[model samples]
Target: MTTTPPHTDPVMHAIGLAVTEARGGDPAAARRALLDLWERTGVTGDPLHRCALAHHLADLHEDPAEALVWDVRALDAADALTGARVREHHAALSIAGFYPSLHLNLADGHRRLGSFAAAARHIDAARAHSPALARDPYGDLVRGAVEEVADAIARRDRAPRAPAPGPAS
Candidate 1:
């Protein structure tokens, strides 16, 4: 049975609290809490912390464009976590585990902005790098999100576009 390191639990708990607050209709408070956590982590903290912070922050933004910025940052931070870097915090950390969710979020963000091509690319990446853990709820969630985005894209494609206006008279 895999277990999260004791040291990482506090951070995870804090993130969960912030997420709950956001989902409970108090996004402003959630944003402030996440921002505070981000500030505490700074640039020199563990890559995992930065990745988590950026990922959660992305969800707080009402604008898809702005959310995409945070999603990209989360992916960057996750990608930068080498074995040595990850060992500093989570000795048994599987860096590959982060890619699926990060890519899934990016796909959703891109889809929201009507960037179907970019969204498809990220969706493929998510599928390719998905974690192999058994009964991982987060992985299931990512898979569901990928399907949702794909469906949205399909619906958009089937939508008829209005004719373009002629040049001014």
Candidate 2:
């Protein structure tokens, strides 16, 4: 899984902590915590929680195919999210801004699986929606990832990206 670092909203504090744990090198503990939260959230629960949980969970997996499953779930939940709902958590965020990273992660996963056609399609979507990203470091990070994934797809490289959060173990 590859995406820009996630944005933390006050309402998502628990998730933020688990994500921090994942980044801090305790993936097993983080995964357990996240899964517990996922259970509480339920399958048809809040789209925001579903999106964030699936997105972060995807990055904890070492298998590309497994990561892709969570990425797809994240995208599905993202599609159900609304701007109003996102704004409830953080006024600075828009649902549109989430697409680039979501698509980027999917692209990277597909690229690693040798699904270049799908990878190209998703990379194109990521680029097309990238202008919605803020003119800040967060935006730069996602855009940079978009470029890297695109490059990898163009070269038909299936090897994982170095230091990639998931799909590299």
Candidate 3:
């Protein structure tokens, strides 16, 4: 049987394109595209779109402070999302699944910014929320990241992790 691709919203398509641009070595274009989409998404637009766009936008920033702002936006948007709403994009998605990665990013950013206490809090939160993940590659990936960031916090490492962020991030 031939399985069909899941239907996606235009905003998601645009977000994907912008991410692709960043991965394809045109971060300036990617930033512009995502920023324009952010304006379209507005402050109270679709929670899923806002969460996704903000998350990816954070990946594009090397500055911990700027990235922290976007990561916080992603986390906030995730809180506003619902399973029913996310199911519109992917039947397998859960808002609970979003927290591990969101908190991981925040933890990493805080660690980089010398906010070890906050980083520890977020890393612990990421671990606490990790059981919501499926035993798939995505789950494993986030779990690995949790460990990595936790170690960074423990060492009080205030440097950016190698392979910092981009399309692949």
Ranking by lDDT: 3, 2, 1
Q: What lDDT tens digits, residue by residue, belong to model 3 across residues 1-169? A: 2322333478888888888888888988998899999999998999988999999999889889999999999999999998888777777677899999999999999999999999999999999999999998778888988999899899988989764343342
List model 2 lDDT by residue over 80-144, tens digit each.
99987877777667999999999999999999899999999999999999999998877888898
Candidates ranked by TM-score, best first? 3, 2, 1
Better of 1 and 2 by lDDT: 2
Local accuracy by lDDT, each model: 0.73, 0.86, 0.88
Total clashing pairs in model 2: 0
Over 4 Å off in model 1, which ranges?
1-4, 7-13, 83-93, 131-133, 157-169
Q: How does residue 80 of candidate 3 score in lDDT?
A: 97
Error of 2 at 14 (Å): 1.1
Model 3 scores worst on lDDT over the 10 consecutive residues at 1-10
Q: Per-residue lDDT of 1-169 in model 1, one digit per residue for the tens?
A: 3444635667656877887777777989989998998898886676777888898898778788888999998998887788665555555556777787788778777777778888889888887886543355555766666676667666654222221122110
Q: By the lDDT metric, which is better: model 2 or model 3?
A: 3
* Candidate 2 Cα outliers beyond 4 Å, as residue runs: 1-11, 163-169
**Model 2 Cα shift for residue 70 (angstroms):** 0.6
